[model samples]
Target: MQKYPMTKEGEQALRDELQQLKSVERPKVIEAIAEAREHGDLKENAEYHAAREQQGFIEGRIQDIEGKLSNAQVIDITSIPHTGKVLFGTTVSIINCDTDEEVQYKIVGDDEADIKNNRISISSPIARALIGKEEGDIVVVQVPAGAVEYEIDQVQHV
Candidate 1:
């Protein structure tokens, strides 16, 4: 089984979602299906069909989260001493060499990557280039828009 590298927060988020799906969504769907069954005519029961479909989705997601958690290698970055080097779950500050714009991104697992929240996947090109590099290092990343150079300004465990 491939181990999924994730931060403590990422693991907690997945566990929380799994709990919600199991305790809340699963029971709600089961109740809905039971209520729909009382309406009779299983052949033309749209509510029943929709409820069953939703139950399937919730169960699938629960299983997926369980599998991920079982294979997850949760990393508590705060437990490690900061070395000013970029690693998985570390927040990085990079300055654009071309536009002189600065941006901060927290390198996280694929499931936790949200660009809007400044979280980037470890497999992304920029994150790949940033990994193993230290502060003050200039790294070039090849994106769809072409090659972009970014100077590593800071690396934080938080």
Candidate 2:
């Protein structure tokens, strides 16, 4: 199996989710299942069916988290030496060459990419364009909206 890159923070987030699933959700679902079972006939019970479905979902999520964690290659961004260039886990500040709009994004693993949080996947077109480029370098990214040019303003490993 291929190993997947993940930031330390991402790995911890997955571990926390797994812990919550195993310690909290699993027990709660078991309790719910037991309570539903006490309501009598398992064949026609809607509560029992709902609880069983929820249990299945929880178990599936738990397994998925476990698998990802096992395959994770946790990278500590803070420990990486600053090279004044874009790399995985590097927070980059860029200026839109056309619009003059500045935006900051952290290049992270696929699982940790959250657009709302300004975390982009390393495999993303913009990140791919930014990688290995130093400050003041201009990169053209191909997006669904078309090609956009951005100037690298800063790169920080934080």
Candidate 3:
């Protein structure tokens, strides 16, 4: 399997989630299964079936998180030198050339990308367009709606 780039925060978040699943969720499911078993008649036991299904989902998620954590290359943005160029883990402020509206986004790994939080994946069209570009540079990105132009106003490593 190929390794993927991830922010340090993203890696830690995944680890924390995995820990919760294993330490808290797994034990809760086990107890639920035990309680269901005591009721007898497993063939028609709805609680038992539901508990088993939930266990399967929790286990699958735990494995997925473990795999992602193992393959992650955590990048610490704070350690890098700020050169005013758009790079991974850099927070970029941009102005829509047409509307002159300002938008800020933090370029992060795929796992950490949340539009509501203003965090974008490095693989996203906007981030791809901004990568390697410096502040005051204008970039045109091809989006599903059409091509959009943005001017890089500032770049900060946080």
Q: Which pairs of residues have clashing backbones in candidate 1?
A: none
Clash pairs, candidate 3, are none
Per-residue alpha-carbon lDDT of model 3 for 1-158, expressed as tens digits? 88888999999899899989999999999999999999999999999999999999999999999888888989998898888899999999999999999999999999899999999999999999999999999999999999999999999998
**Model 2: per-residue Cα lDDT over 18-67, one tens digit each:** 99999999999999999999999999999999999999999999999989
Q: Backbone clashes in each candidate structure, one number apiece?
A: 0, 0, 0
Error in Å for residue 140 of model 1: 0.3
RMSD of each: 0.7, 0.8, 0.7
- Candidate 1 overall Cα lDDT vs. reference? 0.95
Instruction: List the candidates ranked by lDDT, beginning with the highest.
Output: 1, 3, 2
List the candidates' TM-scores in order: 0.98, 0.97, 0.98
Stretches > 4 Å off in candidate 2: none
lDDT agreement with native, every candidate: 0.95, 0.94, 0.95
lDDT of 1 by residue, 26-59 (tens): 9999999999999999889999999999999999
TM-score of 2: 0.97
